[model samples]
Target chain A: MNKFYKNILGGKAGIIGLAILAVLLLVVLPSSLQIFRLNLVGKYLTYAFVSVGLVLLWGNAGVLSLGQGIFFGLGGYCMAMFLKLEASDPITTKIQSTPGIPDFMDWNQLTALPAIWVPFKSLPFSLFAVVAVPALLAFILGSAMFKRRVGGVYFSVITQAFALILSLGIDGNQGLTGGRNGITDLRTLWGWDIRSESAQYVLYFVCCLLLIGCILVGRFVVSSRMGRLLLAMKDREDRVLFSGYDVASFKVFVYCLSAAMCGIGGALFVLQVGFISPSLVGIVPSIEMVIFAAVGGKMSLLGAVYGTLAVNTGKSLFSENFPQLWLFLMGGLFIAVVMFFPNGLAGLWESARARLSRLSPRSGAAKKIIPMPAMPQASNLVETEPKLP
Target chain B: MLAYSLSEIWSILIMQGFSGLSLFSVLLLMALGLAVIFGQMGVVNLAHGEFMALGAYTVYLSSQLTEAYAPGFAPYYFVFAIGIAFCVAALVGGLVEWGMMRFLYKRPLDTLLATWGLSLIMQQAFRSIFGAREVTPTLPEWLMGSFKPTETIDIPINGVFVMALSLLLTAGVTLFMFRSRIGLRTRATVQNRAMSEAVGINTGLIDRFTFALGCGIAGVAGAAFTTIGSTGPDSGSRYIVDTFLVVVFGGSASMLGTIVSALGIAQTQSISEFFLEGTMGKVTTLMAIVFILMIRPKGLFPSKVRS
Candidate 1:
């Protein structure tokens, strides 16, 4: 009984809304005029996968982790490792005879394959890693942090530090991580050639379908009593602790889930871009992921999608057109968003809807909505974030 | 066999110590700015490295200008450039604080995100303005040579100068914070913004100065850093993570914590680098910090918990 489902599925209007979304996703099928928007729609859907997790962690759990990109990078690197191992084998087996063998092995004077990389030669193992590494890391870090009564900025800092160290570690071990060059020259994902347009079309659709599933899962998690309790933790951790709830477990659970979803996004990203690197896993990219979540909206699942699409799409277009001043424009854009649109594009929609409903009070077809504050937020580092007493 | 003369070994140790101290100075400079901005102002300025870059670029530009326009006094133009760079960086810091961050003082995470986005923009800006290549700055003639206590142990004079300058800067900053009227007010505001404001302090101005002072220090660090390393668009990122680590490990909002943590990290990094390769050294130091932080999450000297 999620509000989203109630709004768009329980009633007749909900069915209509569902139909509209379906139509939007399949815009190219019914009309030739909408063909151009198809690819963009798919790309946005992929971005939404990352954003959905943000909504769960930042919006409900009230943890503003600034290193989602690390999770994404882990996932992307996992997938890329499999793809590269499969691809590099043809050229590398002559000098080396191992499943996980890479070109750098010859360069590093190692004829034998590294033990840790052996399992990744299999596709399933890589997929497992995409989910495993980030989950394990998040679990360990989140457990230690939450168990010690650390949240807010301390949590943010520690997570950022974790990301920096990981990326740097990967860079330092050049043979294992492919150094700064990263794994590239990807041929295909499984049997599907990535360079093919038809393959991309399927991949993009998969992103859209997965995005819907991701959203559904997020909604489900956030609607349960557990979700309510977690939100309450955000509002007041001490009170939650006093109530005999294991706040540490709850935080670790959500942190792992967020990391998993980010991993999924990372996998999809490598599939789309056909490349992965240490740079993609660094602190800057990690921070950028948080920014994408921030600029989109921190309240709803849809906002994560909205934020990533807006920022990424805006960057691609603006940087291409005005290479000299795009950054200044982006800086100005962030200033505008934070100052005026605190809730991001999601807030913009809410305001627009409010104005429309206010214009005709007598028409009570749709009720005005004011969302409740989900959690306690008295302990933000800079007096920023929503504080509830 | 790793055999060497006693004097040779002495020189090696001295040289490494000088380099280590110089490296420590740079870390302190970067950490100091980060501490003030993050500690006092509560805005995690992610583009801090960019501000440092601006300082280096300012020095580079000033040198070019002086050489072209006033050849006789070209060598002395560095002092003027450092001042200009400090002002420009401070102004940029003020602009960032007043523009985007002023509103985000409430959402620390939002400030982190927004400032990070701003950092991307700044990097691109720098790349476009000054070509992406490293902008190397040559020091004056008097500062170029090495100090030779022994034939085998010649230490770079520039490194010694950097260490000296860092000590002077730290002492100067200490006086500014504890001795000056404005500095005390800034410290007061950081302690308790609401309390300070109720007592007739202009908390807003204090925020600006705190931010500007941090950026100015970063600018000076950038100017000094030019002699030791190549300045480039993304070079600031190199120091930023270490700076954050120092700021966090030392204790947020404590100047003494900043210095202690910085010196500790720098020395560890240098000594480990000598024993291990660069990567292993960094990994060891970071693991140590992580373990330390696990024990004390709020850091070594974090603000006392409010009841």
Candidate 2:
């Protein structure tokens, strides 16, 4: 029974954590939250996908990408293209000078759809493109940088530069993209009304299911040999490289995987939010995505999802009432999370659990103490083992 | 597009080249401070541009004060403002280093996120105080207007002033780093923190002072920047990526590389803009930087060092 418990849930705490998230997503949120608010939660859950990917990439592999928004935007734009085309059908857009093409293109005096838009007309193609585009981009970028041994701060700044370039490109190409306003007024997906109450509820459940799947994927990866290799790489890249591991390939694979995750999130974000824009793919939003991961507990995939919900909720609440103080509050959260709670919300939970277990009467015999290294290595990156005593 | 004569095109290229030089000066000023902080301390300070913005705001405030109460002092207020900008930025940098940065020295990624948060606060603070509009200080008579170096090659006096200021600061920084006792200690601490501490060097003080000095230079850069560009709450953010690119492209630890990369990036961006659309120009420059970095990940001029 004990072995089964450990194998299935990883730990007793994991079972409880999973149960709580399931209740929140499957029961409480759909019943309690109104359509408007439920849709907002769905939007926030899309960001959770990115944060979960960040848990794997940053927490495990020590690759802190500040440009996940690029993937997210790419995914979102792909989905938006299909929906925009459907909404701008010849019958619907007959009043415009150019019918059948997207309104923005018509407004910009383009007679035909751009070559890129042609492939996105089919739902299967759009769905495939949503994941493929970001994965391809990440693969190219990751291989280029990682193969050349560019990791750490240089990798981060270069990614941010990429984000800047993409936003600039999208915002400038008004005819192709919708410009600053983004692809909005998205009406349907395959003749189903997206803005309806029933549709919103259905999409929310779909988002929750996808999020759970992502968590399971994260759990599986973290428990596998590849996960151990990532941790090893993070702590000792040189040692891993010396051990005959193709470190760059692993990094590239993880990066591409993470990009694919963000891409999925971005596509979902558009579906729920009804818009996709350049603003969401820019430097500021990209960094904000990192903050969500950091705040949630970069180390925990489930915690990252919760963190996204918590931060986004706080953001909407604060911005609605006190717009001016939001930035200061966010800034304070960033500093506090890093300085006091490096492991974030999940770390707090773990520490609390340890304390609770120790306070129990039978704790002395039940607790298992892990031994520390004789002389802790001089490297600052060494992970400190948790102590029960 | 090529309707102009060959001579006209020649003058246009020269004019654009000079404009690029002006951009190079600003980029160098911002990258210099970032290089010091990131290279020596290994802290990715996202708030570095905000320090520059603080400097720009200082100049604007002083100009306003001079215009309202002391018109006679308007001619010399910019010089005084430049000094004040450095001192103010340095003081804030020292406090931040002491209060927050000291604790985060071990976690570079955390430092990056925390500093980004700090930058958001700073940007909002500026917005609250200065309002959302961009502001520029009125140029004094001496600093205003362009002079013709040749009939077709006119250059703004303010741009020249900024370039001269950048040259002066770069020379001063070089002399201080290679010539001074504190410079020696800073380098020692960066090279071997434990050894420097063992040898009785106050590593903590070195860190604080180095961070402050770096920020101070960024402040002066901001003051110089106000002469060329307008300042707003988000002004710092706009330049942050470009400044970081300059630092990374030049090889983070090499001061000479920072200068060269700054000039190269600025010129490429400026010249390319003349040929392509403005957005495309920026895209091309960024792509070039990424491509170059892929081929030579250590950057164009990596310093010889072993960690």
Candidate 3:
């Protein structure tokens, strides 16, 4: 049984984490959460996708990108454009000046669908775009920045500029894109009513499945040889470079992979929320996504989901009653977490377990804290003696 | 592009150029503060804009007080208000540094997040205190009106005043950073923390004073801003990205680079805005900066340091 458990769960802590996820999915969500709350949780889960990516890119690769929302919004907009086009078919939008164009296009007096929106008409193409566009953009950006050796805070600021520019572009182009109101009024996906309760439940399950898949993928990457390279690079880039590794390639690859994850999340977000807008593509949301990763224990993949949920839940609950206090609390949380709890919830959990073990003094128990090599016991490296003269 | 006579194009260029100067002034002022904080100290103060806003709000409040209590002081109230704004922002900045920022000096990204949170809190506070709507301070009578050197081009007095103020502050800061005793210590600490500590420099004190000084400058920038733009809760945030861009694109720690980059960015944005759509103009400028930074990752004028 122990061998079987080890094979399946990897460790005792892993088993506990899996048990929690199972209970949340199979029992708690189905039995306790109503359709409305369940849908909200699903929306929150979409954010988890970005945080999970951040865990890999920022936590492991040591790349702090303040613009993950750009990928998320890109993925969302891709799906949203497809749905918008389908909903704005010739028959439904016949009353408009432009019969087949989206309502925003009709309002802005465009006669034909823009070239960019054409490929989105194909479901397969749009689905591909959900993953491909963000990843491609990330690849271009990552190559440009990383190849030039612009890491650290410089990378964060540049990515943020990209986010700002993307949002401004979307907001300005009212005719081609949907503008500030965003692409909304999405009804069906391949002739299925996404707004229905049953459909919502199905999407919730789909979200859960995808989330689990992402976690497993992240685990696989982080446990692999490349993951160790990422850690080494994070701690000392010069060392990694000297060791005959193309550090830039690893950075580009990890960043692109993270972008793809965020893109998937954004696509799912559009499905659940039924809208995609420039507002979500901007600097604020991008930074908030980073905070989600930070809050979750950047080191832990599963912790990312928990952190997203905790922060979002706190936001909703606080904003509902005392809107003014929420910002103060959030700001305080950021400062406090960074100052005191640098490792976040996962760190807190490990430390608590360590303290418990110390109190119990358990023999032959699996020790979580790996002890470091002891320094020399002697205070002085060279002893000075009068006889030496 | 819009077709026009050669003379008409020349006049339009002059007009756009003057407008760009105002933008340049604002960007320069904001970037100076950011250069000191993010560039020199390596601490990303995301709430730097809030400091600017605080200055704007201080000016607004003083204007109200002068109008209500001392109608005679209305003309000269702005001069005093600028000073008050600087002091208030500096005090708050010092408090924040002592209470929060000092702890996270080792972590840059954490500093960004913490300051971002501070920005949110400040924004909400501004909203609550000053109402959600934008507030504008009444300009002195002398600071009003415009002067036209040509038939087609007109320059506002306030714009000129703001530009002059930015120049004076820039010069003052340049001198302080290069020549002042505290500035010497600050630079030493930045270059080698352990060495500065060994030499009996209070690095902690220097950090606090430097942060406060940056915030104070941002406050002055806000004061200059009120001459052209109305004060709003989130107005500071709107400029934060632009300011950061100016600092980064100019080469973070280089004063000359900050000035040149600010001028280049402002002109690019304002001039392109004349021909292209507003969004397109902004997008074009940002994309250009990103591309240039890609090529010159250290930026236009990176400071030299031995690894």
* Tens digits of per-residue lDDT for model 1, A1-389: 56656632434543553455556565544244243445555555555666778788887888978777788888888998888877776554564544347776656666676887788889988888998988888888888888898778778877887778888888888877787888787877776787677776677777767776676677667765567767878777777766667878888898899888888878887887777888877776776666577677776665677687778878778878977777777766765666677687777777676667768765464363434334433334213422223
lDDT of 2 by residue, A11-94 (tens): 866688888999999999889978899899999999999999999899888999999999999999999999999999999999
Error of 1 at A200 (Å): 3.1
Q: By the TM-score metric, which is better: model 1 or model 3?
A: 3
Per-candidate TM vs. native?
Answer: 0.90, 0.94, 0.94
- Candidate 2 chain B minimal-lDDT segment of 10 residues: B298-307
Off by over 4 Å in 3: A1-9, A361-366, A369-389, B1-10
CAPRI-style grade of the A/B interface in model 2: medium
Candidate that beats the other on DockQ, 1 or 2, i.e. the better one: 2
Candidate 3, residues A236-294, lDDT tens digits: the string is 78866765678899999999999999999999999998999999999999999988888
Candidates sorted by TM-score, best first: 2, 3, 1
- Predictions in order: lDDT: 0.76, 0.88, 0.88
Instruction: Give the worst 10-residue stretch by lDDT in candidate 1 chain A.
Output: A380-389
Location of the lowest summed lDDT over 10 successive residues in candidate 1 chain B: B298-307
True contacts kept of each: 0.53, 0.77, 0.77
